[model samples]
Target: MTVDWDWSYTGDILPDLLKGLRYTIIATLAGYAIAIVLGMVWTLLRRTPFAAVNQAVRWITEFIRSTPLLVQLFFLYNVLPSWGLSLSSLTTGIIGLGLHYSTYTAEVYRAGIADVPRGQWEAATALNLPRSRVWLDVILPQAVRRVIPTLGNYLIAMFKDSPLLLAINVAELLHEAFEVGSKSLMFLEPITLVGLLFVAVSVPSSILVRRLERRYATY
Candidate 1:
């Protein structure tokens, strides 16, 4: 069987796909920023001296990681409005993505912080440094640097996962492809374009992350 290809149709749908791509990139960057910041917060919370706070944070993180992100998005997008906490679809999508991935990033942070030489903590204690100063000056710098490549991997995962936001009506890349395909009743061109676009972006990003890991391997 011969398959028909439509170059003209592909050109016509390019604009919509590109527009979706813009939203995808925006969502990925915004969500990843939230994940990075909140993940560190979660890790620190779990490290608090109080057992209750540590247990609470541990439970919360585990819950977020254990559930499906789509369910979280639906709850945020659909259920919250009834509780007078309504949010825009895009906003809800970003929060869901960020909240879900923050758990994973928190684990990455925990590992990074653990890998810091024990002597660094001893030095901070001997210096009589304040807790904040110890973290900001002595610990986080090394931990964050060591985890940069792993964090970048999460960012790439977040980018690929941004399509899940379409469930909440966020118009990301795969959503636009579906719209184009549905209108024309031709799935081949638009879907193929989406795959190609994802590959184009993700491959280079993965390569960069690998290079970073190699560069920092000795540090």
Candidate 2:
């Protein structure tokens, strides 16, 4: 009595599964957006001349990178309430994802910044360019171009990690699949669909990142 696949049963649950997929996509986009901005800020702070500021940023980034993302998500969603700061599950997931990944992305940004030519800095200094204008117009533009591939890779990583939002009850794709499969006792089809959906997206995204790398080749 081993019934493997049922097309009609899968069809019945497609809508609910799609709803979860939508939430997963939204959370990934929101979280990545925040992570990009926060990571850039951290990278810029790391460049500050003050030793204390640099050390503080380094220590904090290390602390975040060392921690498990699941624990961080729980702390933000559950424990923050005790400190008079509460967030919705989706918002908590977004912030938690942002903070966790920003630590890694900051290092990517730092590497990009380091790749900028020393001559460019010297030229800016010779031209009497304002510090802000030099950094804004010259450095970041070049650095961003160099780092797009790295950042895109992080985007894919963040997309995959979005399922962890289930810890905060965000109802992302895998969580939704689990819910439906649990009730119907048909885990195979729903879970298979989830894997297919992830593969369908991730493969194309990885290809796009590779193209971006070629586009920005050092040569």
User: What do the candidate models score in CA lDDT, each in turn?
Assistant: 0.93, 0.93
Cα lDDT of model 1 by residue, 10-114, tens digit? 999999999999999989999998999999899989988999999999999999999999888898898889999978888888989899999999999999999
- For residues 1-219, could you state the per-residue lDDT of candidate 2 as single tens digits? 986899999999899999999999999999999899999889889988999999999999999999999999988988889999877899999999999999989999999989999999999999999989998998889988999999999999999999999988999999999999999999999999999999999999999999999999766
Q: Estimate each model's TM-score.
A: 0.94, 0.94
Which candidate leads in TM-score?
1
- Candidate 2 Cα lDDT to native: 0.93
